[model samples]
Target: MIVLRNLTLRRGARRVLDEASAVINPGEKIGLVGRNGAGKSSLFALLAGTLHEDAGECLVPSVWRLAQVAQEMPETAQSATDFVIAGDAFLMAAQAEAHAAEASGNGERMAHAYTALTDAGAHDAHARAQALILGLGFRMDELNRPVNSFSGGWRMRLQLARALMCPSDLLLLDEPTNHLDLDALVWLESWLKRYEGTLLVISHDREFLDAVTRVTLHIERGKLTRYGGNYSDFEALRAQQMLLQQAAYEKQQAQIARLTKFIDRFKAKASKARQAQSRVKALERMERLAPVLAEAEFSFAFNTPTGLPNPMLVLRDVDCGYLPPVGASADTPPSLIVRQVSCTIAAGQRIGILGANGQGKSTLVKTLVGALPLLSGGRVEGKELSIGYFAQQELDVLRPRDSPIEHLTRLAHTVLPEGESRREQALRNYLGTFSFTGDMAYQPVGTMSGGEKARLVLALIAWQRPNLLLLDEPTNHLDLATREALSVALNEFEGAMILVSHDRALLRAVCDEFWLVAHGRVTPFDGDLDDYQQFLLDDARRQREAEKRARMQNGQAEQTSAVRKREYAAARQTAAQLRSLKRAQEKLDSQLHTLQMHKQAIEARFAEESLPVDEITVLGNELKALNEALDAQEERWLTLAEEIERIEAASS
Candidate 1:
């Protein structure tokens, strides 16, 4: 357990936290959320004891071990397992060596082995190590790979394994979901849900908070408020608070206006002098609610080209990857990361691709936009399609030296190239829509923060209202407010979208489908991710049920025959698998039904739209493009029929 009393942290003139008092109890999960500059990470550091608390007391249990992730890579030459087994590594090595020596049956070595094993707690260490390794995605084959050989993302996984391996009562995780794939993330969430220890995690991930934590600790307006529920509950409470504040502000303004008028009228009259004096005193004594909190401005407008398609994109057996380099010598092969990727995204379809780090989501997106080369594969057909692509590494695509205004200007030309004066005006108006006013628009892209850079990217993309939009991990390091804004804007837009992100809440909010990835080569599961998860839970339930049933059937589990035990185990496993498959098929059926309804709705709307507006004479090739999108979803549904049979059979 940890407690903070009257904690005040300041950075120069800015008072980040003022008189903040918080208590973290045993087995309580707390999610810390705030704006970009709200010092959530700074608060974590203060608690970690890496930074000094200028004003107050931090009471922590001495035995409460804390692990906070280091943003920077530390200098170390240890292997992956060595790094993960960092806590008391020497003892583990000594015990392993001692056990090996004792197995040889030598008297002197046996004496040494007994001393080492007893000191190292080797009797129970094997079980402990096994649980930790298996939980963190480690297998027997990968137990000894060098840590330096892995990339930064994989290195983070090693660090997390180390944190979990140590028997710490308190876990302080900062952005644990940043480098994790969907499977790893779900595992981490499941662990925290059942963990007996205390956790204070800082994350902007909606689903993570909703799944793991019961209490929401929000940092807003230089103070901390503890709300008694998940993110959705906190949001509802905050909305109520804002409404009260707005009503109070309005009432105060009316009272002030009335008092001022009375004072002016009575100041000149002798009979009302006492009343005037009292009124002035009252005005002076009234403490106006700490200067009304200003709402941050956000601006951006869509400048859509008139002649665009209804069906945004179409892919056919497309294999794509980044080129190694231009003009390279012979005997070099291109990196073909994505193989046989095909999908037809129709208007109003919000699709999200879920997968691990290297699983061709980005590659597929790049190929769709013509940014990467398509290998030997099928054709993608959709003419007169306008696309707005936002890659994860936006810095690579946008010029670093250019200002936000300059970026908008370039995009304006790309969107509407008919006239010069109208294009300039369009750029200016579009920038205004994304909250970029006069001088702020001139800020260089290189100098902006990650959030600012992402906002600018959105600004540029909205400047040209494309029929198809592609986004990659747009929620990384973003605050909840900005993400909510994106959710609103996307939901309102009349276009097709393809997104690649690991944020579960964002997926649930924006994407209608595409939970599974393009193929089976990326991250291994028990099989499919959703199916695997269902199977795990079902198996556990069945095992527990079978044990209970065996006890009841035999009148005593301890006295049961070996043949009966074997029979129960086999039946339990089979029953569990069938149950999981049955549930999975039901879910797929529901999803398919929803997809069909949405497609029908789209058709109904298309039929009712003014046909004269989409006339070939008026709209040119764009009308033909929109017509094809109407049939694409139906075709996709037909292809899924065969897969449905496989699911149904497994369940049976």
Candidate 2:
């Protein structure tokens, strides 16, 4: 457990926290909520011992451990497993020391060292480490890869995996879900649900916090207030709190007015003199409460001009795709071909392309935009044909040396052609409109995050306000809050959009039509993207049910082939072998428990005997080894339990 005893934090001239006291109890999962610069990260760092509170003590038990996501990369190369193992560094060091003592002719020290390492789970700690590593989405083959080879995002994941590996009474996690994908987020949510230790996490991911945390500690205007319930419930309760505060303020003001009138009328009277002074003191002492504004939200609305051509883009007997460069053609694709393929996209057409990986949805868009040449016959037409393309192509068009503002300032004039002076001023103001406030406007384009860079590029393009929007996975690397803002903006947009995205929710919200590209052909469908999700789900369900029925009826109609019979027998034998192995593991675990406890007993006796400091140190080594062994056995049991549960569930 960890306790923040009257903590005070300041940022420059601002008081971010003032005498805030909070307790994080064991097994309690908490969500830290606050606006930007409300000291959430600072508080987390303080808890992690990476930052000083300046005023109050953070009281944490010696056994309490904290884990934080590394926003920056470490110097050395490391793999996913290496990252998690780093969390076990303390125990690993103890292990090495225990072995060294045994070699140095100190039998008591050797015995004590062995016990401490064993108790700390050194015997089979690798399996525990691997399990924790795998839970965070590491492939078995990636265990040995250098951590430096990973991009910043993957490095964050490695940092997170290591944090999860650390067994601590209390854990503080900051923005834990920022780099996580939906699937990994779900897994981590489930893991936290079953975690026994106390945890406090600062995350912008609503669904994640809702699923995992029980307590919401909302930081508003540098004040800490705890709310009971999940995030949605917290929001509702916060709204009620705001309303009540306003009501109280109004009641106080009304009474103050009455007092003012009474004092003014009775000012000349002797009794009124004391009463007026008292009222003035009350007014002076009253802390006037300011209203808390709602979170910042983006407003999205755009309209297409009338008198547009129908069937704007069309392809006939054309293959739309590109192959990697061949021979000396550095940037040229081999070709993209569609045989007897015909397609037409008209004004007001909202389409989504659905296909497996490696399908040419992006290629089709490139061909339409003239970024890729059409291989066959096609006619494309649009009235005044203005288009805005937001691709996943890295937005590498921005010159790295130039500031974001400088690049954007140049693009506006170049793209608009006749904008000249007035438009440049409006464009500068527009960049500020999208959070490029003052100094941020001058930050180098290369220095921005992927999400920020994408938004900046989109801002420049949107300034022109084109008729067509071609977006490809625009939500990648964006935090959920930003994604929500983008959603609102897209909803207000009126231009025809051709979107290719893996986000079902986004596609459902924005699209009115669906397009499927496969085998170099185009298939158009009526209705919205929700229909596509339904179709996919329904198909998957039907396939699953069909497989279940087939499996059940296998013996009735078709006897198993000899090859299948052999496979079944092999599976049964493997299951039996695993069961036998599980029993042996349980037996070994029981014996190991006895050994570790005996070692602890010896160390405790040594501590009570008032021996020399060196003798006590020898006993301490034994205790450390004992702890490691216990951890290792516990880890083994967990793995066996999981394996057995899975096998039983699958059979059932």
Candidate 3:
């Protein structure tokens, strides 16, 4: 158990926690939430034994092992698996002891050390580490790659995996989902649910907190409050409390006003002097209630587009991926990731991109945003098309040396019309709408927090008044309130949108359709996010099984006989057949969907009273034809799907 008794903590001159106290029992999963800079991180430091309370008691069981993700980026040549396995301190210590005993030529000591190493599960360490790595969105081949070869974001993921690998009674995670995609985030949620330890996480993602935490611990105005249940429950209960508190305060103010009026009128009169004095005494004895101040509200909306271009952009058989390296030959063709993706973006259409990490979701988005060149196929834009893109690494586009006002002023020059005012004050006023005000507007962007940086990028995008928006991981650094505001703004946006995000709430609120990028193809996802999550889990399970089988095969003696070669050839043929059938099934499914939609549209026209008898007859006949086509496509789709299933079953 951990206990805090009237704990007071400070960072520099500011008191982050003032006489705040809370008790956390062992094995309880707690969510530590607060507005940005509300001392959540400070509290985590206190628990991690890095920061001491200024006064009062902060206690944790001395025997308990603790684990936390390291903040510093790792720069090592060690293989990813080895780096993760090193997280297990106990196993490492035991192995070191065994080595030392063998070097000393002490048989008894070596035997004891070997026993301890086995007890620590040294034999399965590699497997466990690899599982954590793969579950965090790394490919199987990346397991042997040097840690430093990965990007900063992937390195952070490795750090998280390392923390999870450590054996601990307590685990502290801070913004764990910041670098994860939806697939990895879902996998992490499942993993955390099964962890048998006390867990405390600091996150601004409401859905994540709701999913992982059973208890909510909120830090506000230097006070710590613990609530029973998840973040949603805490929000409901807190809102109710605020309402009651406000009501009580209003009633008290009314009573105080009445008392003052009575005292002022009668205090001077001789006959009423005693009564006036008594009223004054009553006022002095009353306990004053403090006004309930709401948290600072932050909201912004996208400026309505000057023109709504129907079918803002079209990608025709586009092969989307990365271009060759800078030093490579100019004639070299781009490496294709998603092949032959054909999609149209119309006014008011909202599309969500879903896929496992490294499966071309980002590649497709980059191509659409015109940041990456198409490997093949042509891209068409409407006459009045205007695009605003928010890349996953949006911060890289910002000039850190420039202030918000300077950034906006430069944007105004390029985006705003000539007649529009580009004065510093006007730009400052505009920046204020996104909560950058006064000196903060003039503050250097490099010194701003991640949330502030993200807000600035959004503000820049809004100023464009684009009819089409492409956003990738836009909510990564935003707080819950800001995310809610963004969701509301997006819902009201009349522009077409393509979004790639790990935030399920945002996806559900903004997307009208979903496109899945997988296996070098872009296809429509027929179901919702829940279905996508289940698909990822199933895929992960299958991949693990395949890896196990491959390992088993590798351990066996090589079979070079003609019979074995023939068997392998037959297996490859079956696999190719399965792939072809799946592609055919996808095509038929798309055809069926189109026919069904056409049928529904025609049927809906029959309800119109303005339609004449002849028109109704024509619509009825067209609907019948659509239904027939739909039935035929559906039958073919089912047959192909069944064949795919059969092939899959045989392979398994």
Best by lDDT: 3
**Tens digit per residue, CA lDDT, model 2, 499-526:** 8766555667777777876566778866
Using TM-score as the yardstick, the better of models 2 and 3 is 3
Residue-by-residue lDDT tens digits, candidate 1, 357-440 = 566777777777888767766555467777888887874577778888788777566655578634656566667667666776
lDDT assessment of candidate 2: 0.70
Per-model tally of clashing residue pairs: 5, 31, 0
Better of 1 and 2 by lDDT: 2
Error of 1 at 172 (Å): 1.7
Candidate 3 wrong stretches, greater than 4 Å: 330-333, 417-420, 544-652
Which regions of candidate 1 fall more than 4 Å away from where they truly are? 74-77, 87-141, 290-305, 320-338, 396-402, 409-429, 437-439, 518-652
Better of 1 and 2 by TM-score: 1
For model 3, give the RMSD to the true fold: 16.2
- Model 3, position 652, has a per-residue lDDT of 52
lDDT at 62, model 3: 97
How many backbone overlaps does candidate 2 show?
31
Task: Please give, for residues 1-652, the per-residue lDDT of candidate 3 as tens digits.
Answer: 9999999999999999999988898878899988888899899999999999999899999999999999999999999999999999999999999999999999999999999999989998998899899889999789999999999999999999999999999999999999898888987986886677899999877888888887889898999988766789789978998999999999999999999999999999999999999999999999999999988978999999999877789999999888888899879977888999998888899999998777898899889988898889999998888899998788978999999999998888886676546888778888999999999998999999899999999999998888899999999889888999999999999899999998898999999899998899999899999999889877877887787779869886665689778977998899788778777865774576467556646766887679998998888788888878866886776677667666755775
Ten consecutive residues with minimal summed lDDT in candidate 2? Answer: 298-307
The residue ranges of model 2 lying beyond 4 angstroms of the native Cα positions read 11-14, 74-87, 98-152, 261-287, 293-408, 417-425, 428-432, 435-458, 470-483, 497-652
Give the number of the best model, judged by TM-score.
3
TM-score of each: 0.72, 0.66, 0.83
